[model samples]
Structures are given as structure tokens and as C-alpha cells.
Target: MPELPEVETVRRTLNQLIKGKKIDHVTVHLARIIQRPDDIKQFEIMLAGHTIVEVERRGKFLRIIMDGLILISHLRMEGRYGLFTSSDPVAKHTHVIFHFNDGTELRYKDVRQFGTMHLFNPGEEFQLPPLSKLGLEPLEESFTLEQFKAVLIGKKTKIKSVLLNQAYVVGIGNIYVDEALFKAGIHPEQSVNSLTDSQFERLHNAIVSTLSESVEAGGSSIKSYVNGQGEMGMFQHQLQVYGRQAQPCENCGSMIEKTIVGGRGTHYCPKCQLYK
Candidate 1:
């Protein structure tokens, strides 16, 4: 799944491509992907004739701001968006297509068919599920070290599980969680309460810096992820431990190990991130 950096990169690329373009029509080949209004026709009618005012991202969800309605889209695993001329042949997995008045179309393709779209009225999106329960953005100024520490108090869950929880910190998935934990030199299986003040501070800084650097590098392309322009991310070159199982660690020359933590595959350097 694409994490914060990948989603932010998609938002940036999508904004550049589709912003200000009027939706001439909408075709939903997969009705199950539309979760709002529970009616496919209503979803199509509400979106037609409205211009895509802007594209914003809340956590991993893409907010397609239109004239009067907001379309919230979550691109789950194997989901991608691309812009192409109307004459271009639609791909086999293309699930949704937003035909623009300018003879271009914004297409959403999902191999797993797990992507979702919800249409909501302006200002009402955050009051509902998914977005309502999300925690603070790590990149934002509001996510201070004090707030982060406060959220972790009394939590008995493993640190990896806690980090994956959207209520604790939004937009972090397995890939970045492993990367962040490895960078902080904290074992993924450690309990949240076991972390000391200094460890928490290190973890906080690692989370922020890892995400910031990944976003600047266009996110890690570990899987099939790509931005709206179909460009692969460059951050995969900077990965420390994630997906480097059995490979030599750059810092200590020890073999990077992989283990299951909280049901997710975790990678770390055994010598660096030793269990406490």
C-alpha cells in the first residue's frame, strides 16, 4: 500500500493534471468502488458538469474538490491513477474514468478492485468515518513531540502495531513503519510502553525525517506504485532495512533480518535494533 509520501506525491501530480478541468461525464465500470450515496447513478450525476477545483490529500485519502461536492478516494493496494486522451484505449483494470471536457480522461485502475470512493458535501467529510478518527499528520506542525508522547501513554500494543494504527498516526503503512523503526534503532516487536523518553524522541524524529525525505524523493516504489504521470519514485534507493532481509546493513555490516510483527512483515538490522 502507498503510505503518506506516496499518497502526497499522487496528490501533487494529480492536482497538476486534473485541477480546473470540468468533468464532462463519469463512467464507473465497477460500481462497488463507489461507496457514497450507495447509488451509482447518483454518484455519476453529482459529479457531472462540476469542475475539479482542486486535489487535496488527507492522510492517504485523496480529496477531489469539485464545485459543490467532495469526492474522497482511497487508493488501496495496487491502485493507480493516470491521465490520458479520450482516444487512448482504456486498460483492462481501469475501474473508473472521469471524462473531462478537454478531451482528456482521468482513469483509476486497481488490480485488486479494493479502491473506494465516497462523495460527501463540503465540510461534512471530516465528520464521518475514516477521516474523522484519523490522528494528526506527522508532517504538520501540530504533531509535536509532546502530543506524540501523550498518545502512546498506557498503550500496551506493540510499537509496530501502534504506529500502523490510524488513530495513533495516520498515513504510515508497513513499508514506512519498518523503515522508521529501523532508522530509530528500535525493534519492531517492542511494546509501546517499554520505550524510554529518549527512544520516543528518537522515534518521533525518525518518523518525521523519514517521511519528509521520502516525500522529497517522490516516495519509495517498492511495488507497483507510481504517481499520476506514471513516474516511479526514487526513494527506494535510500531504504535502510525494509525489504532488505539477509542483506548486509550499511551501518554495522550485519545481515538485515525479517520477522513477523503484529501480523506484518518487518525488517531490521539485528545488530542495530536489538530487543531491549
Candidate 2:
């Protein structure tokens, strides 16, 4: 799953490529990918001639704003978008294609077919599913330290699980969660209710700093992530613990370890983030 930085990078790239481009047509090869309106044909018809006014991102969801409707796209694991000439051969696993009037097309390819798209009226997207359930974007002014702490209070879930919950704070997945926890020196299994104000502050700062830096670096290309132009991200090169199990920690030379927390593989430095 592409986290906040990766999704934000994709949004920036898509904004540059597809904004102002009028949709010539839309092809939905995988009907199951369209969730809203529950009709693939309606999804295609609504976007056929709509012009992309702007591209925005809410958490990990890509919001492609058109004339009166908004297309909410979530590129789940192994999902990616790329812009190509209409004459270019469609790649394998291309599930959706948004053809542009300029002879170009934005292709969505997902090997796992786990990506999803929902079409909603511009003002109604937030009042319904998906977007309605998402929590605040960490970069937004509304996600203050106090708010983050308040959400953690009385929550018995592990700190990692709380951070991963989209209802609590959106756009964080396994990779970035591990990275953020490692940076904050908070063990993935630490109880959320047990964290002190100082630890909460550290975790908050780590989330913001990690995401900001990754967005600047074009997001981490850990798996199949790429931008609108089919470019790979560069932030994976700076990863501290993710996918580095048994490797020495960069900070203290302690061996990085991996364990399953909340059914997800988690990596951290035991020496740095030991159980309290």
C-alpha cells in the first residue's frame, strides 16, 4: 500500500500531467474496482467528457476533481498510475484507462486488483463512505499534537495499530509506520495508553517529519509504487528498518529485528525500542 508520501507524490505528478485534460472516454475493464454508484457503466458515462479541474489527495486516496463530480481512487497494494500515448500498447494488468482528448491516456494497473474507485458528487464525497471514514492528514493544520494525544488516550490498542488505523490518522501503511516508529524509538508493540506525553510528542514529530521528507524525496519505492510518469520513488534508499531485518541499526549498531504485530510484519531496533 502506498502511504501518505507516495500518494502525495502521485497526486503532484498527476496534477502536472492530467489537470485541465478533458476526458475523451473511460474504460473500466475490471468492474469490481468501481465501488460507488455500484454501476461500472455509470462510472464510465459520468467521467466521459468531464474535464479534470484539479487533482488533490486526501490521505492515501487520490481525488481527481472534474466538472461536478469527484473521482476517489485508492491505489492499494501493487496499484499504480501512468500516463501514456493512446497509441501505446496497454500494459498487462491495466484495469482502468482514462482517455484524454489530447491523445494521451492515464492507465491504472494493479496486479492484485485491490485498487478501488468511487465516483461522487463534488460536495458529497466526504459525506459518504471511504473519505468520510478517513481521519485527518498529518500535514493539515487540524492535526495538532493535542489532538493526536487525545486520540491516543484510553486507547488500548498498540501504538502501531493506532497509527495505522485510517480512522485515527490516515495515509500511514506498514512501511512508513515501521519507519516512523523506528525513528521515534517507539516499539511497534507498545500500548497506546501507556505512552507518555513526551513519547506522544516524539511519535507525532516523527510522523510529520518522516512523511514530509519522504514526499520531498518522491516517496519510497519499496514495492510496485510509481508516480504518474512511471517514475520510481527515491525515499526507500533512506529506510532505517523496513526490509532490513537482521541488519545493524544505523544509529546504535544494534541489530534490526522483525516481528509480527497486529498481523503485520513490523521492524524495529530492539535495543532502541524495548518494551517498557
Candidate 3:
């Protein structure tokens, strides 16, 4: 799945491609991919003639700001957005396409069919089910170190599991979680409540630093991830332990190990991130 950096990169690319374009029509090749209004036909009908003013991302969801309604999209595993001329042939697994007035189409292709779209009124989007429960954005000014540590208090879940929870913070997935934890030199299975003030500070810094650097590098391309223009990300080549199992640690030359923690494959250096 594309994490914060990957999603942010897609948003930036899509914004550049389709920000002011008007949607002439919409086609939903897969009915199950549209979750809003409970009817796929309505999803296509209402989007007709709607101008895409801007594209915003909340957590893993993409908000394509139209005239009065917001189209919320989540690109789950194996899902991507591509912009092509209308004359181009529709590729396989293309689930949704937004036909623009300029003879171009913004296509959403998902192999796993796990991607979802929800339409809501502009002001009502934040009050909706999925968006309402999300916590603060890690990049925002309100996410301070004291507040970060407060959230970890009394939580016995593994540090990685706690960080993975969307209710705690948004836009973090398996990829960033592993990368950030590894950067902070914290083991994935360490109890959240056991972290000291120094550890919390380090983890918070690592989260922001890892995400910012990845976003700057256009995100990591691991297994078919790309921006809206079909360009690949370059951050995967800079990864330390996420996909480097059995490889020497970049810092201390310790062999990186892989284990399943909270049902997710975790990679870290056992010597560097030892449990207390």
C-alpha cells in the first residue's frame, strides 16, 4: 500500500494535471469501487459537468474538490491514477475514469478492487464517517511532542501498532511505520507506554523527517506505485530496513532481521533496536 509520502506525491502530481479541468463525464467500470450515495449510477451522474477545482488528501483518502461536492477516494493496495488522452485505449483493470472537457481522461486503475470512492457535500465531508474519526496530521503545527507522548500513555500495544492506528495520526501505513521506527532505532514490538520522553521525541522527529524526506524524493516505488503522471518514485532506493531483510544495517553493519509484529512484516536491526 502507498503510505503518506506516496499518497502525497500522487496528490501533488494529480493536482498539477487536473486541478482546473472540468469533468465532462464519469465512467465506473466497477460498481463496487464507488461507496458513496449507495448507488454507482448516481456517482457517475452527479460528477458529470462538475469542475475539479482542487485535490486534497486526508489520511489515505483523496478529496477531489468539485463545485459543491467532494469526491473522496482511497487508493488501496495496487491502485493508481493516470492521466491520458481520451483517444488512448483503456487499459485493463481501469476501474474509474473522469473524462475531462479537454479530451483527456483521469483514470483510476486498481488490480485488487479494494479502492473506494465516496461523494459528500463540501462542508459535510469532514463530518462524515471516515474523515470524522481521523486524528491530527503529523505535518501540522498542532502535533507537538507533549501531545505525541500523551497519546502513547497507558497504551500497551506495540509501538508500531500504535503508530499504525489512524485514530492516533493520519497518513501512516506499513511502509512509513517500518521506516520511521527503524530510523528512531526503536523495535516494532516495544510497548508504546514504555517509551521515555527522549524516545518519544526521537520517534516524533523520525516520523516527520522520514515522511518529509520521502515526499521530497517523490515517495518509494515498491511494487507498482507511481504518481498520477505514471512516473515512478525514487525513495525506495534510499530505504534502510523495510525491504532489506538479512542485509547489513547501514549504520552499524548488524544484520537486519524480519519478523511479524501485530500481523505486519517488520524489519529492524536486533542489535540496534533491542527490547529493554
Candidate 4:
């Protein structure tokens, strides 16, 4: 799953490429990818006349804003979007295509076929499922330290699991969670309730700084992640702990370790982030 940074990158890139492009037609090569309206034809018809006003991101989902309706797209796992001339040959696994009036097409391809799309009215998207269920937008002005601490009250789950919960804070996934925890020198298995005031402050700052820096670097391309123009992210080079198992820690020179925490593979510096 692409985390906040990766999704934000895609959103920014898509806005540059497809914004103001009028959709002449829509073709759904895979029906299951359209999860809303429960009707493929309706989904296609609803999108045709609308011009793409802009592209926005909520957590890990892409919100393609049109003239009257909003299309919510989740690029689960290996899904990708690209703009190509209509004369170009459609590649394999291309699930959806939004044909523009200028002989250009925005194509969606997912090798795993796990991506999803939902169409909703303008303001109803925030009041409905998925979007409605999201918690804090960490990058926004509202994510304060005081607010972060308040959410941790009564939460006894492990630190890794708590941060991964979308209801607690949106857009963090396994890779960034591991990186953030390591940056704070807190073990992944540490209990959320056990964090001291100082540790809580460190963790909060780590989460913000880690994500902000990743977004600047275009996000970590650990898997098949790419931007709208098919560019690889550069942040993976700055990773400290994730995917560095058995490798030397950049800070302490101690070997990094990996373990299972909350059913996910977690990486950490054993010497720096002592397990309690």
C-alpha cells in the first residue's frame, strides 16, 4: 500500500497532467474496480461530461474532482495512472481509461487488480464511508502535539499497531511506521500507553518529520510505486531502519533487526530502540 507521501505525490502529478482535461468518454476494462453505484454503465455515464477540475488526496486515496461529481480512487498495491496519447497501444492490466477531448487518455493499470473507484456527489464524499472514517491529516495545520497525545489516551495497543490504524491517524502504512518508530528510538512492540511525555513528543515529531521529508523526496519506492510520469522516488535512500534488517544502523553502527509486531514485519535498531 502506498502511504501518505506516495499518494500525495500521485495526486500532485495527476493534477498537473489531467486537470482541466475534459472527459470525452470512460472505459472500464475491469468492472470490479468500480465499487460505487453497483452499476458499471452508470459509472461510465456519470463521468463523461464532467471536466477534471483538480486532483486531491485524502490519506492514501486519490480524489479526482470533476465538474459536479467526485471520483475516489484507491490504488491498492501496484495500481498506477499515466497520461498517454490516444493513438498509443493500451498496455496489459489497464483497468480504466478516462479519454480526454484532446486525444489524450489517462490510463489506470494495476497488475494485482485490487484497485477501487467510487463516485460520489461533491460534499457527500466527506460524509460517507472511507473518507468519513479517516482521522487526522498529519501534514495539515490541525495535527498538534496536544491533539496527538489526547488520541493516545486509553489506547493500550502496541505502538506499531496503534499508528497503523487509520482511525487513529490516516495514511501511515508498514514501511513509514517502522521508519518513524526507529527515528524516535522507540521499539515497535512498545505499548502506546507506556510512552512517557518526552517519548510521546519524540514520536509525534518523528512521524511529522519523516512524512514531510518523504513527501519532499517523492516518497519511498520500496515496491512498484511510481509517480504519474513513472518516476521512482528518492526517499528510500534515506531510510534508516525499514528493509535494513541485519545491516548496520546509520547512527549507532549497531546491526538493524527485524521482528513481527502486530502481524506485520517491523524493523528497528535494537541498540537505539530498546525493547521494553
Candidate 5:
């Protein structure tokens, strides 16, 4: 799954490519991918002829702002978007196509067919599921160290699980969670309540620094993830422990190990991230 950085990168790229383009028509090859309106015809009719005003992201979802409606799209694992000329042949697994009046089409392709789209009124999007329950943005001014620590108080869940929960802190996934825990010198299996105030501060900083750096580098392309322009991210080169199991730790030269924590495959340095 694409994390915050990857989703943000896609939002930035799609905003540049599709903004101001009028939708001449919409083609839904997979009917189930459209979750809004329930009726496919209504979905197509509502989107057609509407101009894309902007593209924004909340958590892992993308919102394509139009004249009066907002199209909220979640690109689950293996889903991607690309822009092509209408004359070009559509690629396989292309689930949705937004045909623009300028003879170009924005295509959504998801090999796993797990992507979803929901249409909502302008001001009602955040009041509903998915976006409504998401926690503060880690990079934003609202996510302070005190707020982060306060959320963890009295929680018995593993630190890794707590961070992965979008209700507590949005935009973190398995890869980045492992990296953040490792950077903070906290074992993934550590209980949230076991962390000291100093440890919480370090973890908070690690989360912010890791995400900010990944966004700047486009995001880690560990699998099939790519930006809206079909460009692979460069952050994978900077990974410390996420996919580097059995590799030497950069800080302590200790062998990085992998273990299952809260049902997720977690990687960490045994010596550096000592269990306390």
C-alpha cells in the first residue's frame, strides 16, 4: 500500500496533469470500482462535462475537485493513474477513464481491482467515512509531540500497531512504521505505555523526519508504486531497515532482523533497538 509520501506525490503529480481539464466523458470498465451514487449511469453523468478544479489528498485517498462535486479515490495496493492521448490504446487492467475535452484521457489501472471511488458533495466529504476518522497529518502544525504522546497514554497496544492505526496517526504504513521505529531506537514490539517521554519525543521526530524525507524523494518504490507520471520513487535507496533484513545496521553494524509484530512483518536492529 502507498503511504502518505507516495499518496502526496501522486496528488502533486495528478494536480499538475489533470487540473483545469474538462471531463468530456467517463468510462468505467469495472462497475464495482465506483462506490458512489450506486448507479453507474448517475456516476458517469455527474462527472462528465465537469472541469477538474484541483486534486487534494487526505490520508491515503485522493480527492479530485470538480465544478460542484468531489471525487474521492482510494488507490489501494497495485492501483495507479496515468494520462494518455485519447487516440492511444488503453492498457490492460484500466478500470476507469476520464476522457478530457482536449483529446486526452486520465486512466486508472489497478491490477488487483481493489481501488475505490466515492463521489460526494463539496462540503460533505470530510463528514463521512475514511476521511472523517483520520488523525492529524504528521507533517502539519497540528501534530505536535505532546499530542502524539497524549494519544499513546494508557494504550497497551504495541507501538508499531498504534502507529499503524490511522485513527491515531494517519498516513503511516508498514514500511515507514518499521523505518520510524528503527530510527527512534524502539523495538516494534514495545508496548506504547512502556515508552518514556524522551522515547516518545524521539519517535515523534522520527516519524516526521522519515515522512518528510520520503516525500521529498518522491517516496519509496518497494513494489509497483509510482507517481502519477509513472515515475518510480527514489526513497527506496535511503531505507535503513524496512527491507534490509539480515543487513548490517548503519549505526551499530548489528545485523538487522525481521519479526512479526502485531501481524505485520517488522524489521529492526537487535542491538540498536533493544527491548527494554
Candidate 6:
């Protein structure tokens, strides 16, 4: 699954590719991928001639802005998008295609068929499920140490679990949770409330730095993830502990360990992130 950085990178690339392109028609190869309006045909009919105003990212979802309606798309595990001329042959596993007036098509391909799209009125998008319950954006200036500390108050769950919860903060996933916790030198299984002020500050900084750096690097492409232009991210080459199990820690030279935390595969430096 693409985390915050990957999703943000998609938004940036898609905006550049299709921001002003007008949708002449839409074709849905898989009906179940469209989850909005409950009627698949109506979803296609309404999008006709709608101009692509811009693209936005909320949590792990993409909001393709239009005139009065917003198309919220969630790119699950294997979802990827690419822009191609209409004359190009459609590739296998292509699920959705947004045909633009300029003879170009934006294709959505997902091998797992787990991607979802929901259409909602502009005013109702933020008040509904998925977008409504999400917490502060870690990449934004509002997600300060004080704001993060507030989410940890009275929480006894493992720190990794808390960070993975979208209700606490949006855009965090297993990869980032493990990487950020490792950078902060905090054990993934440590209780949230047990963190001191210094630890809290370090964790906060780690999360932001890890995410922002990944975004700057165009996001990690450990899997089949790609940008709107079919470009793979380069951040995976710089990862420290996420997938470096049994590798020597870059800082302390301790062997990186892998364990299951809250049902997710977690990696960290056991000696550096020693539990209290």
C-alpha cells in the first residue's frame, strides 16, 4: 500500500498531467471499483464533460476535483495510474479510463481490484466516511509536537499501533510507522503513554522528517507503485529499517530485527531502540 509520501507524489504528478484536461467520457471496466452513488451507470453519466480542476490527497485517498462534485479515489495495494494517448492499446488489468478531450486517456490499473472510487458533492465530502474521521496531516504545519502529544494522552496501546491508527493522524502506515519509530530510537511495542516529553519530541520530528524526505525522494517504490507518468519512486533505496531485517544498523551497527507488532511486520534496531 502506498503511504502518505507515495500518495502525495501521485497527486503532484497527476495534477501536472491532467489538471486542465476536460473529461470527454469515462469507461469503467470493473463496476465494483466505483463505490459512490450506488449506481455505476449514473456515476459515468455525471462525469461527462467535467473538467479536471486539480488533484488533491487526503490520507491515502486522491480527490480529483471537478466543477461541483469531487471524485475520491483510494488506490489500495496495487493501484497505479498512467496517462497515454487514446490511440494506445489498453493494457491488461486496466480498470478505469478517463478519456480527455485532447485524445489522451488516464488509465487506472489495479491487479488486486481493491481500489475504490466515491463521488460526493463538494460540501459533503469532508463530512462523510473516510475523510471525516481522519486526524491532522503530519506534513502540515498544524501537526506540531503539542498536537501530537494531545493524541497520545491516556493512550496505553503500543506506539506502533497508535501511529498506524488513522483516527490519531492521517497518512501513516506500517512502513512509515516502523521507519519513524526506528529513527526515533523507540521500540514499536512501547506503550504510548510511557513516552517522556523528550521522546515525544523526538518521535514527532522523526515522523515528519521520514515522511517529508520520502516525499522529496518521490516515495518508496518497493512494490508496483508508480506516479501518474508511470515513474517508480526512488526512496526505497534510502530506507533504514523497514525492510532491512538482519542487516546491520546504519547508526549503531546492531543487527536490525523484524517482529510482528499489532499484526504488522515491524523492523527496528533492537539495541538502539531498547525498550524500558
> What's the TM-score of every candidate structure?
0.98, 0.97, 0.97, 0.98, 0.98, 0.98
What tens-digit string does per-residue lDDT give for candidate 5 at 20-69? 99999999999999998899989998898899999998888998899999
Q: Which stretches of candidate 5 lie over 4 Å from their true place?
A: none
Task: Give the alpha carbon lDDT tens digit for every residue of 1-276 in model 2.
Answer: 899999999999989988899998999999989998798888888888889999999999999899998999999888889999999999999999999999999999999999999999878999988899888689888889999887678888898888889998999889889999988989999898889888889999999999999999999997678888888999999999999999999999999999999899999999988876
**RMSDs, each prediction?**
0.9, 1.1, 1.0, 0.8, 0.8, 0.8
Of models 1 and 4, which has the larger TM-score? 4
lDDT of 6 by residue, 36-80 (tens): 878878998999899989899988999999987799999999998
lDDT of 2: 0.91
* TM-score of candidate 1 on Cα atoms, chains taken together: 0.98
- lDDT of candidate 6? 0.92
Candidate 4's residue-wise lDDT over 55-93, tens digit each?
Answer: 999999999999999999999999999999999999999
Candidate that beats the other on TM-score, 3 or 4, i.e. the better one: 4
Q: Tell me the whole-model lDDT of each prediction, alpha carbons only.
A: 0.93, 0.91, 0.89, 0.93, 0.93, 0.92
Worst 10 residues of 3 by lDDT: 145-154
Clashing pairs in 6: none
Displacement of residue 23 (Cα, Å) in model 6 is 0.9
Q: lDDT for model 4, please.
A: 0.93
Error of 1 at 15 (Å): 0.9
- Give Cα distance to truth, residue 158, candidate 2, Å: 1.0
Candidate 3 regions exceeding 4 Å error are none
Clashing pairs for predicted structure model 3, backbone only: none
Off by over 4 Å in 4: none
| Candidate 1 wrongly placed segments (more than 4 Å) | none
